[model samples]
Target: MKLEHRIGQLLLIGLPGPQLDLMTRSMLQTIQPGGILLNTHNIEDAQQLVELTATIRSLIEVPPIIAVDQEGGRVDRLKEIYSPMPSADLFRASGDAAVAARMGEIASEALRTLGFNVNFAPVLDIASDDGANNGLKGRYLGSNLAEVVRLAGAYLEGLQHGGVVGVGKHFPGLGDCALHRVVQQDQCSLECGDRRARALPGLRRSLAAPLVAVQEHSHGIIA
Candidate 1:
């Protein structure tokens, strides 16, 4: 693929199903997006998922990467009948890397079974002092950077072992920010040298993993 086409492939797009047929046709005919992301609103059931993916693939000259936010825990989108997963913090609370690995394996397997190739998950944010860092209340793996990195790495490894790609998110750290980071008004702990170093470990792990891509959260560079 040319650089232009390769760059095109990096784009992930969301489209409504009712209009998917037309929109996909247009994207293929025009934009030729590299991938399509399915949201809860676009999914109905197993058959629907298969049908939607098939239709979208048919439109594109190359098969587009299929993705979804199937993180177990609070951010799950595929919750029609699947078993609910505990949040990352809950996994860390278990204090067992094995348990976290198992959960990641299960999450990857479920998404693989559902025909999703990429899963946006393993939120590797640090959430210490829950009262002060309310934003990391649930999505966090742990407050300690070293432990968080270890646990998150285990989870990503498990997911990869299950043939599913894992993506790390909300870069530069958002654990200390108040809830809804973009709207929040608090100085992030990342400003602290040690805290900033903590956040990078998980990202480094993801960079080493054979992931599809890291979902860049909409936060401008702090400095």
Candidate 2:
């Protein structure tokens, strides 16, 4: 690949509508980005979603990665057409690894049917019970590191089995910080480092397990 094309592969961009407009088509043809991440604005229903993704894919020579934040609960993108999924906390409460795994399987099936290849899910953040102010309260697996690893591992397994790739998120951790607001970069780094230090052992163990497959995406870097 040319250097320009190689650089384009690093971008995973989003469009503003359910269908590709002239500008989106032009951009895709020019850059040929490696992936596209869709949100609620780009999805109307399952059929529309399938068509939109198909159109986007047809524009590029290489198969592009189609991704969505289908983590269920408050972050789900398919809630309008699909059944609402329970929060991550609910699975942790059940204390059954299979529950998380089943949720992943169901989510993957829905996403794959809609032409999506990736699901940003199985939040590994260990949210506090009173984490509403921190923005990660109900989205987390649990505050217990062991439980988070167990549930997240199973969830990853289910996603892979269902033909969708799962991307574990908000690393090194976001349980204590509210990402909606701004903070000094230095302070942010310190907090993230602390959280990682506390969670590192469990993270290592989880990654070493056969079922875990995670990729990090930083959503709050100011640069």
Candidate 3:
């Protein structure tokens, strides 16, 4: 591989505008970027995204990976345009693996229709009642390891079947930090040994699905 290709592999860029289309095409042709991460800002409509992705991919022999944070509920970028998604905790509360699976599939379909190849989903972070919580509240499945495992598994399964590569995130347990505020957890030094144990079960389950990768959060270390 060329040095240009090697450098491109390290970038996970956000899609800018039409003016940059030529530049974007040139970069992909010359460097072959590793992936493209999308957000609500990039989403205008399903058709637009499809065209944009097609244009970008045309520049390379192999299509570049396209990623998005379409975790569902409040985190869903297409919530306003598509069906409303349930929170991860809701799936856990229902204890219905089928429901979780459906959610993932639905999310995957929505993303794929918009030309995305990857989804940052199935948050495996366990939530705690403590003030130092890191679960991201409604975004979390539940505090119970068993519930988290089941729900995340189902969600990933759906995404996989829909041809979307799922990514489980915020490793080492985000179960004990406050939301909104930037609270970091040192997973390597948590006093509560149970936190690691609780989070692992979900991580293991998430990985068991057809996932592409797992994101190590910026928070801190993982033992």
List lDDT for all candidates, in order.
Answer: 0.70, 0.77, 0.72
What is the lDDT ranking, best to worst?
2, 3, 1
lDDT per residue as tens, model 2, 73-192: 888789888999888878888989889888888888888999999887878777644444555667888777777888888888888789888877666666655444446321234656
Number of clashes found in candidate 2: 0
Segments in model 1 whose C-alpha atoms lie over 4 Å from true places = 1-7, 132-135, 180-198, 201-212, 219-223
Query: Which regions of candidate 2 fall more than 4 Å away from where they truly are?
Result: 178-189, 197-201, 207-223
Ranking by TM-score: 2, 3, 1
| Residues 183-210, model 1: lDDT tens digits | 5644444364256555575458543354
Question: Which is better, 2 or 3, measured by TM-score?
Answer: 2
lDDT of 3 by residue, 1-223 (tens): 7887878878777767632466666766887788888777777766677887777677655568888888876787876578777878678779898999998888888888878888888787766653454446678876767667777888898889999988887665566644443344444345444565555654674444754577766656444
**Worst 10-residue lDDT window, candidate 1:** 214-223
**Of 1 and 3, the candidate ranking higher by TM-score:** 3
Model 2, CA-based lDDT: 0.77
Error at 20, model 3, angstroms: 4.0
Tell me, by lDDT, which candidate is best: 2
Best by TM-score: 2
lDDT of 2 at 15: 91
